[model samples]
Target: MAEYRLKTPLSNEDVEKLKSGDIVYLSGTMYTARDAAHKRLVDLILNGEELPFELEGAVIYYVGPTPPKPGEPIGSAGPTTSYRMDPYAPILIEHGLKGMIGKGKRNQDVKDACVKYKAVYFGATGGAAALIAKAIKKAEVIAYPELGPEAVRRIEVEDFPVVVVNDTFGNDLYDEGRKLWEKK
Candidate 1:
């Protein structure tokens, strides 16, 4: 019901204040890690190895960006389907990840993690990659460069647009909107 401008490394209090369907323009640092990167990150955690980046209060965006053209920070930075990252999400959430940005629905376990951990799931417009790219001011591959597009990148964003799809309070915008718009 409200719009908020958020910065990365959000606190539990910051996440708890968001609700499903709220519009958010996020700034500051966020990580990009699709399926492959997520698996690797989890493996690092399970093996007691130091992660390439800090996880506490971090926001991870599920994306496998296109190779940038010369002189661009990123290209067609679209959100990947979030479900593909579901298997690894809860593990990351348990370790202090505060938010995720992606597209499509996440499983119940992922939602449960959001509620239990006081985190949130944000949805970026699936087909708006080109527009999204403009918000990314800087990008640098932090690990798994061999994964190419799936490589984990640390990005700085300015007013990166997204919507609250799942909130810490256990509300799901996809489900709530469906219930409201379905033919009676």
Candidate 2:
């Protein structure tokens, strides 16, 4: 495993260099989207309509944060369960999405998409919302404000930590780590 400090709008070259179990500290821009936001984005694609945000090389973080306190950009912004996004992920990946940050296992189709598209999935530590929110320096709703916390928000992060759970090479850290710890 290696360590990388990457900026958002990650390139295929940047993703290809990562492997499962690697540590990554991401900076720059990333979008926050939960299931509702993902479905909306996918709907736009299917309709041949314009999307609110550019897909190419974009990183989507699966989160729905609480309302912020005074002087903060966000509140308790941790990753949501990733499985909810699996149905829409392949479609987005096909459209040039480069990275996803979330928790839990993704389905086979999602993994296959990652390999085919040269993308990667990073896992954020669960139950660490307060700690994670510290990295988010700025946030602005870019679409679907009606969804409230589930709205699509463009965010700026600094040194946002994550672990490579699924890499472009098809390695899955959860599976690999489980196998290592399993006893006969």
- RMSD (Cα, Å) for all candidates, in order, is 0.7, 0.6
The residue pairs that clash in candidate 1, if any, are: none
TM-score of each: 0.98, 0.99
Candidate 2 lDDT for residue 45: 98
Which model scores highest in lDDT?
2
lDDT (CA) for every model shown? 0.95, 0.96
Query: Stretches of candidate 1 above 4 Å error?
Result: none
Q: Write the per-residue lDDT of candidate 2 for residues 44-105, one digit (tens) a residue.
A: 99999999999999999999999999998998999999999999999999999999999999
User: Once model 2 is optimally superposed onto the true structure by TM-score, how far is the C-alpha of residue 36 displaced, in angstroms?
Assistant: 0.7
TM-score of model 2 (CA atoms) = 0.99
Clashing pairs for predicted structure model 2, backbone only: none
How large an RMSD does model 1 have? 0.7
